[model samples]
Target: MRHTVERAMAAERSRYRRFWVAEHHAVPGIASGSPPVLLAALGARTSTIRIGSGGVMLPHHQPLVVAEQFLMLEALFPGRVDLGLGRSPAFTAPVRRAMRQEEDPPDRFADDLTELRDYLDGTGAVTAHPVSDRTVPMFVLATGQGLAVAARLGLPAVLGGPLLESPDLAAALAGYRRDFRPSPRAQRPVVTIALDITVADTDEQARALVLPEAWAMARSRVTGEFPPLEPVAAIVDRPWTDQTRRRVEATVRHAVAGTPRTVRRRVEELTERTGAGELLVTTSTYDRAALAASDTALARIIGG
Candidate 1:
């Protein structure tokens, strides 16, 4: 895992335009997880790449702590840091209970987010000592009604989930643009859509890689068992009865996986459909080489 991270860091230094590290816990056997160390290391190595949690689940941490941590990161990297905040716990109840503290309600997120803005701007009661008055770009990672909140605040939003499951991308973007209120920082809505993408030399190869993720996700949905990446061959070799295949297909349908050509076409179609300023790509896989290859393929497709 360390080697994979090192290679990814090296690759980011070479040519990647933007990179995001996802934050999650309860992956099979891992415990006491924290992404700050990994993110800090990546920040130190890369000169210009934009890095942040695909989202740091806001409901799990104190706003002040989050603000301070991200403020420190922005101080270290300046101008290249982003803070993407989301509301989901990113784990099941047991894990949440284990991690829960006395101040876990996080009900102050909306108010706290406002306060964080003030602190970062150097106008709040308390300020980050080392990085006082430093402002960094903040994005709210939203689904459903959270879009309205982002739109009203004129904050950029990263929309997740498939178009089929939620408000269509076109409608959501249109709504945000229509209802957007101008803030001092942004006069218009900045929209970024998140999509699951997997690419390989051939469509079949890409599909094969995605099958394990699909199967795992299906199992999670049914039993709430979040496990580490199992071998793709293992998933393929196991008998997926018709009922299981149907369940897995429902989840997989939202993802875009295929050869480079197919990925390019789908991404282009999404761009045309939503007019999104950016598209955030998320891939689920255990192979670092394949992950890097997938990112390269996406860059080519997006003409980055």
Candidate 2:
């Protein structure tokens, strides 16, 4: 993954806006648990492309600590750091136990966001180390009430998952914009939609590219363990139960995968529907080379 991001993504630096890593603790399928640590490595390897978290889950850490880590990142990367925050709980009960998270933690995300911003903007009661005047632009990984929080705080929202395909998506975003209160960080509402998108030479090839991740998703649902991605041939050779097959089909159906023209058309429709200013491609495949190729094709399709 690091190799692909360092060489493949960095190679197409001009065609991509940002390369964001995610935070997933104690998930067998995910290797990187800390976004800031991974971001530091990725930041050192690439120079131009912006690096950030898809996000750092705010429920897992203190707001001041989060600010200090990203501030340290800004000190290292200068203008290339962005902080995308989320309030997702741990992946499972065991994971939550491992993180020492409360069984029924109350939502303090809005307050944490305020505290984090204060530290970043140097308005906090206590100073965070390596503080610089440059504000590391913040974005919320929003869904449902998350959107409302983003609007009230005057921050950009990074929306993904079922919300992107929700029937009420238009109304939800409309409400966000209508209720948005401009802050010093942002004078207007900004929305960035994220989803799995794959581009290949042909529609068939694109579908094939999505198989590994789709199979993984199906298996995770059944086994309660999100395992490492398998090769397409390996996935094809294995026998799948009817439920697994249904889940795999459903996942593939949700993913945007096809030739450049096909992907372009769907993307245009999504942007038109959401009025999103940015699209964050979250494509994952067992084949690293294919993933890179898809990213390249997507960059061209989006005229990046």
Candidate 3:
């Protein structure tokens, strides 16, 4: 845990502007189920860079609890906190039951988001202690109906590559931008697209770094479980069926990885195509040193 936080500090030192922790449940080999705990530590350790949830899965939690937690984060970090939320349901039926959340009707995401917003603004029956003071901005992680929610509520949306991968998605996002209603908190529609961006000294090195996670992704699909990342050397030596190789290739193909120039050009194209205001990047590698090295190389490319 300390190591991960330190890497975030390193990323900030390397001039990455924001750090977001995700909320996941009943997942092995992932550690971001409690965004508040992680974000608070990050808020205390780093200065200047924004710290946020990427996000709190609102369906599994109470709106007031979510409001108070993020408001407390804002209080701690002052002007450097964000409240990113997603309406994703629990990962599985068992997990949903474990959280004591109903399965049929499910949690009312839109209403919860509205209530959370009201709590943040001190306009609800329940007051969020310490008061949000309208300083902490809320961003919705969206794709389908989630996008509509963001548009209707006039909040910024954070979309992943899946939503920016095709023309239909681009068109949908354009519609979102066109029909969005501005709230007092958000004056206009803002979009941030998340991508898997990896950069290294050479194309081969960049691909090699992605191999561990990519292969694991393929292997997990076949095994019905998401496995821990393996070393690249081990992944390279695997005897794979043709279908497995194809699956692995497909998983990594969504990413843009290469030498700095190659990555930079692709990034420019991605931004132009998606019309996104910010880029949230996710890079995964088995070797910690290689990951950090890639960030350093990218830092130079971005003049960070």
Candidate 4:
């Protein structure tokens, strides 16, 4: 995980301003379950790339804990840290119980987010240690009600890759921007769409690169177990159920995978349609090198 992030930083240093890691618990297919630890390490290694959580699942943790961790991260890296919060429930019932004995009530997210921000800014009844007045810019991993909450808080919204493919995407983003209420953190709304794309020398190669993770996503929904990604060669040889095949194809279709030229055009259309200021590329192919190469191709085409 460290090596993969470092390679990305090295290759994208001039092309991108920030690097973010995600949090997933008890998923074998994912390695980043602790964003604070990972981001701190990344912050220590690189001087310029802004390191942050793509977001921390707020429901599983206390607001004070979240504030202290990111405050320390901002202190270590100073002006190059961000705190993106999320509201995803635990994966399974048992996991949910382990994280929160009483399931998180959806209505509490606003209060939770506000308290976290206060703790970071030293406006809470108590203050965070390693004292610094600088506020770490906060963002929301927008999904479900997250977009509206972000707007109300006047924080930037990070729309997920799946949301980018939704039919209502343009309208939804417009609404978020329109309804946004200005706050001390931000006076205007900002939108950043996260997208899944793979750029290879040929369309076939790019399609092949996306198969492993897409197939894994389908298998998880069909079987209730999100398994680790498999090589495309191994996946193609295996037999599939009619149901599984349909599900797998549906997931893969959400992605834009093709030669660099095709990917560039598609991404430009998406940006124009959404009016998003930033595009967060999330290319997840099984092979690390293939994923890195996809990023390289994209950087060459549009990174400048």
Indicate which candidate wins on lDDT: 2
Residues 57-91, candidate 1: write the lDDT tens digits: 76677667777888888888888777777776656
**Cα displacement (Å) at residue 137, model 1:** 0.6
Q: In model 4, where do residues sit more than 4 Å from their true spots?
A: 12-14, 101-106
Ranking by TM-score: 2, 4, 3, 1
**TM-score for candidate 3, residues paired by index:** 0.94
How far is each candidate from the true structure, as Cα RMSD in Å? Answer: 2.7, 1.3, 1.7, 1.7
Each candidate's lDDT (Cα)?
Answer: 0.73, 0.88, 0.84, 0.83
Lowest summed lDDT window (length 10), candidate 3: 219-228
Expressed as tens digits, the lDDT of each residue in 121-238 for candidate 3 is 8988878888755567899999777888899999999988566776678677877888799998688989898888888889888988888878877876676556778898888787
Sort every candidate by lDDT, greatest first.
Answer: 2, 3, 4, 1
Tens-digit per-residue lDDT, 37-99, candidate 2: 888888888888888998999999999999999999999999999999999998678888999
TM-score of each: 0.89, 0.97, 0.94, 0.94
Cα shift from native, residue 13, model 2 (Å): 3.6
> Alpha-carbon error at 68 in model 2, in Å?
0.5
